[model samples]
Target: MIAIDINKRIGRGPGSFRLQVKTVFQFNSVTRILGPSGVGKSTLLKILAGFITPDSGLIKFGDAVWFDSQIKYSKMVQERNVGFVFQDYALFPNMTVAQHLHYGSDNADYINQLLELGELTSLKERLPRQLSGGQQQRLAILRALSTKPKLLLMDEPFAALDSALKIRIMERLKSLFEEQQTTVLMVTHQDQEWEHPKNQIFNLLSQED
Candidate 1:
């Protein structure tokens, strides 16, 4: 399980607010974080991923302590073994689709499986710039999963895909998640984008709240 209680100041002027969040996530479960703009939904994921440090709080995952304020201790992003799919699909422009996945893991069989799952086997040799927006995003997702991280964080991962394609990818991902036993936290503004009986919803409060 993941436990957190943290706070941070975000932005400036009318768009600013104190982002105070406290929550626990069950292990091996799927969670959807929802909120309006400026609610710090993405920021929360950043904090979890170790990109942003909280002013004061603690983050614990099972027996491991990811962050601690009193001791001034915090784990590095890479040390946390987290797989993050950024909102911008942070791909290496110079690298081919296969290279991105390969960088995440050295297992040839697992890499090949991921390529096939994303239907990217045919385009493995193509670089990010050569692929469409949807394909690039798919490569990003596949790369994130290549490591089989314990916690997978995604920010608007399916934003660039058509509804039909998104559904297909999501269905395939559901199976992948089960097979890997990975916990997921996906941020989305559109509620209809995901629907499953096992999905737990966490709605962030606006600063006004």
Candidate 2:
């Protein structure tokens, strides 16, 4: 399990609010963050991903200390063994689908499996610019999943896909996560996205209650 008890004052002037978050993320489970916009959902994900530093507090994952403000220790992003899926589907402009999948992994068998899972087998040679919005989203997801990360952090991961396609991929994605035993923390605004009983939910605003 991972725990985060931190505070960061976001923005400035009258518009800013201190993002005070204290929560525990269970290991080998999917936790969906739920809250209104500007409630620090994505900010919380960034903190866990090591892209942002918390002004105070500590973050511990099992026996590893990811961040401890008092001690001035912060684990590097790559060393944290975490995968991040950006909301904007950060795909390479020049790389094809195959190249993206093969970026970190040379396991052709595993690459094929992810391609099939994402229904991108036929589009493997296509670049991000050539693919549709939904296809680009799938490619982004596959790139992250190909790593088989210890923990995956996603921000509105399914925003581009239609409802039917979202459900279809999510079903297989859940199975893959289970097989890999990957811990996931996702920020979602859609109610039906990964709406399963097994997943945990967190309301940021009510986190202190």
Candidate 3:
């Protein structure tokens, strides 16, 4: 289980608001985080992935204490073994699709499987700049899965793909996640129609709520 109680201040004055999150995320579940534009939805994922730190909080995942504000203890991003697919894709400009997956894991067979799964086998030799927006997004997701991370965090990961491709990828990913029992936290403004028994929704409401 992942339990957290975090608080962070965003912006200043009238435009500012406090993002206070207190919740427990069950294991081996897929959670879709929803909120208004600037409600700090992405910030929550960032904090969980150790990319950002909250002003005060206690983050515990099973036996691991990811953060403890009172003790000034916080885990580094690398130490968390999290796979993150940013909204921008965050791919290496010079690395080809194959190279990206290989960088995550040295297993040749596993890498090849991921390439096939993402339908990126033919584009294996293409670099980020050479691929289309949707292709780049696929490579990003594949690279994240290369390591079989315990926690997968995605920020608007499907925004680049069309409805058909988006649904197809999500379907494949759902089965893969179930097989690996990987916990996923995806940030999206709209809910995808696909549903799974382990799927969950985390709605971050306005401060007034």
**Runs with alpha carbons beyond 4 Å of true place in candidate 2:** 191-197, 206-209
TM per model? 0.95, 0.94, 0.95
lDDT of candidate model 2 versus the reference: 0.89
lDDT of 1 by residue, 63-150 (tens): 8999999899999999998999999998998899989998999999999999988889999999999999999889989988988999
Candidate 2, residues 36-112, lDDT tens digits: the string is: 88888999989999999999999999889999999999999989888888999989998999999999689999999
1-209 in candidate 3: lDDT tens per residue?
99999998877777888899999888899889988888899889899999889999899988899999999999998999899998888899988899999899999999988888888899899989999999999999998899999999999888888988888888888889989989999998664564566678899987842
Global lDDT of each model?
0.89, 0.89, 0.89
Candidate 3 deviant stretches above 4 angstroms: none
Candidate 1: what lDDT?
Answer: 0.89
The all-Cα superposition gives candidate 2 an RMSD in Å to the true structure of 2.0
Q: All candidates: CA RMSD in angstroms? A: 1.5, 2.0, 1.5
As a TM-score, model 3 comes out at 0.95
Measured on C-alpha atoms, candidate 3 has an lDDT of 0.89
